[model samples]
Structures are given as C-alpha cells and as structure tokens.
Target chain A: MSGLSKKQESLIKSLYTRHGRKKHNLCICEGLRCCYEVLNLNPQLVEIAVCSEDFDLSTLPAVASEINFIRVPQEKMKSFSSTVASQGVLVVAAKPEFSKSDDAPADPYIFVLDRVMDPGNFGTILRTAKSVGLTELWFTAGSVDAFNDKVIRSAMGAQFGMTLREFSDLDVLAEELRRFGYNRIFRTTPHEGESCFTAPDLFEKTAIIIGNEANGAAELDGSLSLTIPMPGNYESINAAQAATVILFEYVRRSEGGA
Target chain B: MSGLSKKQESLIKSLYTRHGRKKHNLCICEGLRCCYEVLNLNPQLVEIAVCSEDFDLSTLPAVASEINFIRVPQEKMKSFSSTVASQGVLVVAAKPEFSKSDDAPADPYIFVLDRVMDPGNFGTILRTAKSVGLTELWFTAGSVDAFNDKVIRSAMGAQFGMTLREFSDLDVLAEELRRFGYNRIFRTTPHEGESCFTAPDLFEKTAIIIGNEANGAAELDGSLSLTIPMPGNYESINAAQAATVILFEYVRRSEGGA
Candidate 1:
C-alpha cells in the first residue's frame, strides 16, 4: 500500500468543512465502522480508503480490494481524524446526489427539518429516519450540513442508505410536498396541538416537520400542529428524542398497534 | 462582583473530571441555559455563578442575587468553559445526592441504564426520562459520569431536576427493584422479545433497562426483553432514540390513547 500523498492529505483535511466538501463533491467518513459501512453498502462512491499501519486489513470487506487503499502512520492518521480516538481508518467518498425528480413512487412519509442546527440532533434524527424506513430526508436552508463529520459519526453511517434533499425556502418545500400529493403537513409544538399518539393519518401522505432546537419549526401555512404530551410538564425534550418518539409512533401505527 | 480566585479557578477546571467532581462534591453547569436552569429550579445547590463582564445580568432569574456572582473577562470565561461557544455564564453547584432510603412511595416506573458510555446518549436519555415524568434514574457502574460537562449540556440541565442512583452490579440493581415492588423488569434488545407497543404492563410497577450503546445490556437474570419494532429493518436506531420511543410509549399508554 502507498502512503497518502501531500495532495491527498490536504484534501482529507478539507473534507472537514462544508465549502471544501461541496467544492470537491466528496465527504469524509472516519472510524472503522463508517469506513466499513461505505465499503460494504456504497463502495462505488468511495474514492480512497486510508488506514493506519497497525490497522488490520483482514477485517475489511472484500470490496475494499477494489478501492484505492493508503497506509499512513498512526500519528498521521490521528492528525486527519476528527474524533478524539481515531479508529485508524477513514474513507473519502462522493456525496450521494439526489434531485427533486428522484422521488419514489407513492412515497407516503417524509421528515422535513427546518434550521436544525445542532449536529448531534441532526445526525440522530437521520439515524432514526432511516430506522423508520424513510428513503429520503428534506432540510431547510439553515440546517447544519448533512455531510458534517460530527453528523456522520452521530448518524452511525445512515447517510449511506438514504437520499438527502435541501430546499432553500419553506414555501418552496411546502409547494413541492403538495405537488407530490403530501396532503398532510404536521409541525411539532411544545404544547397546544393534537396529541401525536391519536393524530390521524400520520403514516399516510404525511410530511412531519421537526423544527430548530430552540425556535422550533417556522410556521408552515395550513400545517397541522402536533404535540407529544409531556405529563411531567417539562418545557421540552431533546429535539432528536422528540423526533424519534414521533417517527416511531408512525412505526407503531403502521404496525397496526395502538 | 469579584473576579474568580486562583483556587476557585483551579476547582472549576477540575470539575471536568469525575474524580474532581467527587472530590469537591461539585459539578459545573456551563452555558446560559444550564446556568439559568440551576439558578431557577435548584437555587440552593448553586455555590457560585460566574459570567463574562458583558453577560446581561437582567436576563438572570431573580434568585441570581442570592448567590455569589463573579464577573470575569470574556476570554477568561472561555478558558474555563468546556463548550466551543460559551454562553458567557457558568454555574458551579453541589451535586445533588440521593440514597437508597429516598425512594418515592408507590413509584412504579424506573429507567435503569447498563453501561451506557456515550455522554450524548446518556444525557439525551436523562432529558427524555424527565419529559416522561420520571423522577429518578439508575445506572450501572460502568456508565458515563452523569455530571460530565458533555452529559450536562446534552441533558439540557435535566440533571438538576432528577435524582440519580448508581449500583455496583446489575444483581444489586435488580434486587433493589424487587424490594421497591417493581416486578416487571424489561431489558431492551435489538431483536426478539415483546414489541414495546404490545408489551403488557410497561407502566405498572415496571423498570426498563437501556443497554450500552455497542454491546447492549449484559444478561439480567429473569428480566423480560423488549424490542422496538423497526419497520425499516435497519440494524437499530440510536440508543437515546430507542429509549425515547419506549418512554413516550409509556406516556401514550398512561394517557389512555394507545
């Protein structure tokens, strides 16, 4: 295996920023689990896989052989890593592209995020969205970058399995949703809305909007508001946790359970 | 308003570690939200409140006048903060203490955590637990320190409002649960066991076990296993997300909806 060249090193460092990732059309997936995930599930998008000298090659999947592998010293790998403890492996892959024209036939549910700035919350929401069988995610303009390394790590590689779409304006997103036959648009509020458990038609032609961590969703014209009843009367739960509860309620309802 | 003393500065820095927190019987709450939380909700616990010179005093709760408030330079405040962007306010409070004798009468629900190592997950779980009206939490020995700054930030100061109990062994925890009349002990699993929605008696005299993020719960003898049905058939949702779904299901059932 060859060592990473100076050009490659600079590129890997640049992957940490949104402008750089956009400029190169590439994102970095660090740690052994993410690297393995990209290799196993989306190998075609991977351009290079870098491993520290001590990293075991046998543990890699068969698809690793088809990709360009670079061996670097442990110290060098640490420098390129975003995590406190580097797992000795990293992968640079093309950002999966999804356009407005790529909608699946009769897709009933979509999770729309508006200005969700926290990386951990954004990533956790992605992981939950994927768990609930969502094939695509929509984000408003002010949301954190989907390809951020912290988001990637928190998501545990869910980005590999889902399509992400960004909309510059909420009005435009609402228009597109209506055009796609999503008749029910729901926004979560801390209080004073339909109880999520009893909210009808959550799994049918629905788009649930999870708002920003602090400010919450921008008012969507004609959108129904839903609230998860907090008997404890606490102000709110974590944004990601709230999204998970609502999404899984969709799962619970779809499974024909109460 | 006086600047922090050298000894006080050293103590605040040490509060970042479990050892130091234990030694001082104190924990640090950084950022304006958390500091305000401790000040407003648990005022007696606040030992010292520190803020950058430019921090607005009018925004603080009325109780701020009862505590020692220190004014420091913005740069100095940053030096003592654990977050990327300090909110210009930090509070050092005595860690809330709870013991075996403090169990609430007829308390039917308890969330037990087994070796949950991720600070973000632990904190998110704490936030969800509080939202579900849970007043106490139990943790296995290997779990992350509940007072760690990252945990505090993710929990959004939920720690100030709940009681925490840590056990040296799962057996001891189970025994404690039984003594408290918690007959139904449920451990979450990625697969198998009863579906959370259909699980009988989840809200009646129940204790739910959330496992470690990676390896999951260590086998608890006689514990019933429960699973969140994933329609997407993804490997699993995030641990915090899973806990949220299950906890809110408790809310749903109690509300007589599901």
Candidate 2:
C-alpha cells in the first residue's frame, strides 16, 4: 500500500522550523478538528493525512475532496505529531503570505508581538486577535515560530483566518506598519502609561505590540505605551491575558461607543 | 546527604490531587519564581525542596529562614515534580482556606470557576483573578484541582496571594456567595445575553463565573450572562481569555471612572 511520501512527511515536519517552513512555503495544521476548520476556511490546504484507524471518510469536510487525502497507520501517525495528544489528522497548507503593500481593511488593527517565547501564549494571542477581527499580526524575529506545532494547535486554526508576518527586526516592522497606514503603535506594558480604558481611540489604524512573557515589549518604541491599570497589586497579567484585554477593548470601543 | 523525608516528599506530591491537598491542608508551589514568591507572600510555607545542583542558599527568600529547606538530588527532585520542566525548587505551603463567612473586602469581586478542566487555564484564571485584586475564587467540585502542579506552576505564585475555596457543589457555592453578600453573579459566556461593555456595574459586589473550556458557564444562574461582543465571525474566546477580559473590564469600570 502507498504510504505518505517521504517528501510530504518532511514538509509537514519542517513546519517545526522557521527555515523549513519558509523554504517549503508550507506549514502543518494538526488535530482532526483544526484540519477540518482550516480546510473549510482556507481551501489553500495542499493535503491532509489521517490515521486509518480513526479515519471517517463520511465526516471529512467538502474541502478535503479538493486536497490530497492520505491515510497512515495509527502507530506511524504518532511520529508526525507535534502535540502530546495527536488527534490523528494533519493538514499541510501553504503559508499565507503578507507584505507591506497588502491592503488594510476598513479600520484595521494590527497586533505586533516581540519575542513571545511560549507557543501556547503565541497561539492564544493569534486566536484572540482573530476573534476581535484583527486582519493582520506581526511578530519580530525573536518571537516563537507561529507555525510551530504547539502554536498551530493553540491557535485553534485562527492562523488560516488572518495575515501573519514575521519581521526580521522591529525597526523594519515599524516601517512596514507605517507603510500600511497605521497611525498609532501602542506598546502594551504593565508599568506607568496611559490606561487602556482611557486611551483616546483604538478604533483607528493601530498596531499594538505585546511583549515577551517575562520582560515586556521594552524594545518597542511605539507611539504610545498603554497600561491595563491593574489596581490589585497582584503582579502583572500574563502576556496572552493582557493581549486579550486589549484586543477586546478595541472591540468594545469600536462597537460599544466607548 | 540526608534530604527531604518521605513525609515531606509525600506532602509535596499530594498537592497534585484534590483529595490529598484537602486532607493535608497544603499545596505545592513549584519552579524557582513561584516558590520564592509564595514563600514571601504567605509565609505559611512548611518547607522548601531544592535540588542540590541548583541550590543557591544565598538567593533563598527571607521567609525560608522560618521554614525547613531541604536539598535533594536533581534526579530525585524530578520524581517529586509534576511539571515537565521543574525549576528544581518546590514550596510546600498551607492552602489559603476560605469559607462562607470569610469577610469580603470593600467592593469585593469574586471569581467562580464551574468546571474548568484545563489546569493551565484554571491556573491562568487564578493568576488573572489575583491580578485584578479578586481575593477570593470559588471552584465547584468538577474543576481541575487548583493546587495541581500544573495549576501551581501556571499561577506563578498568584495562588498564594488569593483565597481559594473548592466548593463541593455549585448550588452550595452559589448559596455561600449569596451569604457573602454578592448581589450579582455574572456568568461568562461566549454567546449572547448582554455585552460586558454595556452591562450594569460589574465593579459592584459581584461574583463572576467562568465555566469549562468547552461548555462554558451554562450551569450558573447569574443575574446576567455577559458576552465579549466579538464583531468577527470567530467562534469564541478561550475560557481564561474570556475571564481576563471580564475581570479587567471590572477593573476599568471601578478604577477608570465608569
């Protein structure tokens, strides 16, 4: 019986590395649910691999018909997994490319991440950004690879719903955001700054930078440094939690007439 | 080369189980940062376990002087650990006990977790609740053990800063909150009811219920079920993310002059 080709397996595994993903122009989306989700939303998927034991051909989404569907032994499928709990389905999809010239949507909000190391946090930020209708997200060089298996899983397939770009440097990213007509760059911090609750407006063309888990976006020289105004003295919030607070604040201001 | 006794090791490991934690009235705080933090905040810690290889006695927190500090072999320490990446220090501390009659602080806000299964999410919620100045968190029986090693590590020592109560049942928990004078129970849901941005007075004497990762707070009979109001077609925010958004919104309303 024909098995998953060596080239295909290598491509899926290569998504674990930035170099591999960039070279192949492909990233792996794993878990049966995420595969179906990404495939449904973005039919740009090249192929999907499923364990024969868990394969239910009848439940495969319509988009799966448009892409190569390969079956592998249940035991063999584990080797290709990036997660501890593999759902036995993996999708190989083309990386959605975004550049400086990509047109911004009406009232665009961009999320910039600087050296966020935790794959779970990175993915949750991506999912939260997508939930708030953020069309674009940029990460500086030191940030974790967004296409890493853990991140892809944590993102819950939000990667397929938005534009993701990794810049080599913050200065380069700042220039790119400026080119894209972002008028404000708000760097999220836990320290002294304008309270996010009282910030003038987040509805305009803006880029929000959320920093690393330990040391925040100290490197980013954004136009405004926004703080969440934590009165509790219980230490600062986590990166992803802070990001969601700000993301939904944008949603609140835009929709609730704050 | 005598190290942690069998009793001490057993106590630390017991925190991984709800029954064990409750029986001993103790919980484990793992990792270098959280161990030091919990020790400094609670000072009720009974002991500290450090791997001899990673031990820097000079860097130990001032509170360590009041407790037993044992040095174990690195390999032995791993056996006692619940985390994949233990930082070689774990604090055995008394759990902060709360009951129905525990006095609420002025304008007290309580966080209720119905059946949050994910330890990481539960821990993040605890950290967020602490960060927002919520001194009390109530968890019904089915939620993940708050003192589980993963929750303790994920909480980053915030567990020591707040009062944690695991109620045997939601009805009992609800009755207890009412006795504590919480006028409203705001259940967090991803679906529609009331926009949190437009909801009336989340900063008052309130208890916010964050539910399981999948089913949400369907069990809570809150005065109002609050939604984040996602303008995008994205499915829903993660449990912890939704809780943080609501928690900070309460902060914003209270501190930012709503």
Whole-model lDDT values for every prediction: 0.85, 0.77
Poorly placed runs, candidate 2 (over 4 Å): A1-23, A55-60, A65-68, A99-107, A220-222, B5-25, B57-60, B73-84, B99-107, B220-223
**How does chain B score by TM in each prediction?**
0.96, 0.87
Best by DockQ: 1
Model 1 chain A weakest 10-residue run by lDDT: A98-107
Instruction: Give lDDT tens digits, candidate 2, residues B176-230.
Output: 8788788688777677677888777666778878887877765655557777898
Model 2 DockQ, alpha carbons vs. true complex: 0.70
- Quote each prediction's TM-score: 0.97, 0.90
Interface RMSD, one decimal, each candidate: 1.1, 1.6
Model 1 C-alpha lDDT per residue in residues B1-258, reported as the tens digit of each score: 557999999999999989999899999998877777777678899887899988887787888877778999999999988788889999888987665465553446888899999998899899888878888889999999999988988787889988888999788988888887887899999998999998878879889999998899889899998999998777787788888998999899988875
Q: Fraction of the real A/B interface contacts present in each candidate?
A: 0.96, 0.82
Collision count for each candidate, in order = 0, 0
Q: Look at candidate 2 and give me any clashing residue pairs.
A: none
Runs of candidate 1 with Cα error greater than 4 angstroms are A99-106, B99-106
Question: Cα lDDT for residue A232, model 2?
Answer: 75
